[model samples]
Target: MAKQYTKNLIKREFLKLLEEENFNNITIAMLAERCEISRNTFYYHYEDIYMLVREILRDELEKVDEEFNETFSWEESLLHAVSFLLKNKKAAQNLFRSIDKKEIDSYLYKICESVMSRYVDNECQSKTIDAKEYDKRLVTDFYRAALVGLLDKWIQDGMKESPDKVIFRIGKLFDGNIERSLRISENLDEA
Candidate 1:
């Protein structure tokens, strides 16, 4: 429990620093001073700042995965995921603008792929679409690409619009198209 608390302290301090300066400008000594812990303590909890970021992103993505799976429909799942990101907009934006954009992208892709794959598998089980594994993966990749592109643009724009507006627009564009796309893929497989 004490270790958890210490790690959380380090993360909080790191995020505060992230918002103020570029990630590359921040260092272990700075984070340690902010946390009021020794540099050794910081290293004991995390190998480095990048590793800290990976853990932070992984934890948030896990929440996204869990919430998405718990929801009834893919649309709801997508909304849940987006809401999660918006709720953590500062952290999200900081990571987006951070030097570790690649790491953030990797985590976002993993979360999207996980959610889309589960959505496809559940839809197939419900007979919403009949698709082979390869087709399901292809459809998942398509949705993941669209989602990541949308999110990247949204973040880059500083999340100017409300979450509801973005969600509604995305739903209008994709709410029904996913199943249709999957079905098309299934037909192609059959042919």
Candidate 2:
């Protein structure tokens, strides 16, 4: 448990700094000082800022996935996942924006795809859909990309939507019957 404690401490300090300063402005000495650990101790656990951010992000995802049980629906899972990230918005914003890191997006995508893929495996339609698992992955992966890419765009656009508002819109985005959201095309008979 000592290792876990050290890891958590490092993550906590990293997050604290994120809230107060840009990620680029944050230094190892500042992190070590904030955490009340020596520079050596900080270096002992994490090789660099990027590694620490990645570890903390991956750990956060695992904790959230475990907390929610075997929730398989993409929309429901996204609500939970986004809620978690929104809870730590300052830190996340700093990590993503300052670090120019898409690992967070990629990490979230991997978690989402893993969960959704499992659900798909169990809900195989006829012999047809089940036989096309690769095709199914393609569709699911595309949808997953859209979900994450939209959020990235929103954040990169400087958070025009709060986490709550984004969550609400995402519900609409994935509520199915998406054709309704499109402008109806007018058909002209041959003149």
Candidate 3:
């Protein structure tokens, strides 16, 4: 309870500073000052700034996972996930441009892979596809790569496009073709 509150406060301050300066430029003292907490309190909650960033990324992924679980459609799930980025554009941008970008990319890959896996599982359950686990994983990897690629571009381009517009374009590209594409790949592999 209190611990969670402290962590959240620290995360909030960290993100606030990320907007004004690069993650590398942010220090424990800066965070403590912004949050009005002692430097020891900041260290009490997080081992270091990297730990805070990782926790925030993991927390955001868990949030989207929960939302995805409640969703009836993949589109809804994806939009829910993207809403986090939309809401935290400044923080997101700073993280992307930070020296810790590799960490951010790894986290983003995990979230994308999870989302793709969920989408594949839901589709399989609906009898939309009868794919083997391997095929499903292959498809998941493909979509995850594409999704992450698009996200990298979006972040690099300053996220100028709206999430809805980007999502709609993605849906148009693959909304109903995942199963068909997997089948096509299987057929090509058998040849």
Against the reference, the lDDT scores of all candidates come to 0.76, 0.66, 0.78
| Residue pairs that clash (backbone atoms under 3 angstroms), model 1 | none
Which residue pairs collide, candidate 3? Answer: none
Query: What does the lDDT come to for candidate 3?
Result: 0.78
Ranking by lDDT: 3, 1, 2
Candidate 1 weakest lDDT stretch, 10 residues: 66-75
**TM-score of every candidate:** 0.83, 0.76, 0.88
For model 2, which pairs clash? none
On the 0 to 100 scale, the lDDT of residue 72 in model 2 is: 41
Q: What TM-score number comes out for model 1?
A: 0.83
Best by TM-score, which number?
Answer: 3
**Model 3 TM-score (2 dp):** 0.88
C-alpha RMSD of each candidate structure in angstroms: 2.5, 7.2, 2.5
On the 0 to 100 scale, the lDDT of residue 69 in model 1 is 61
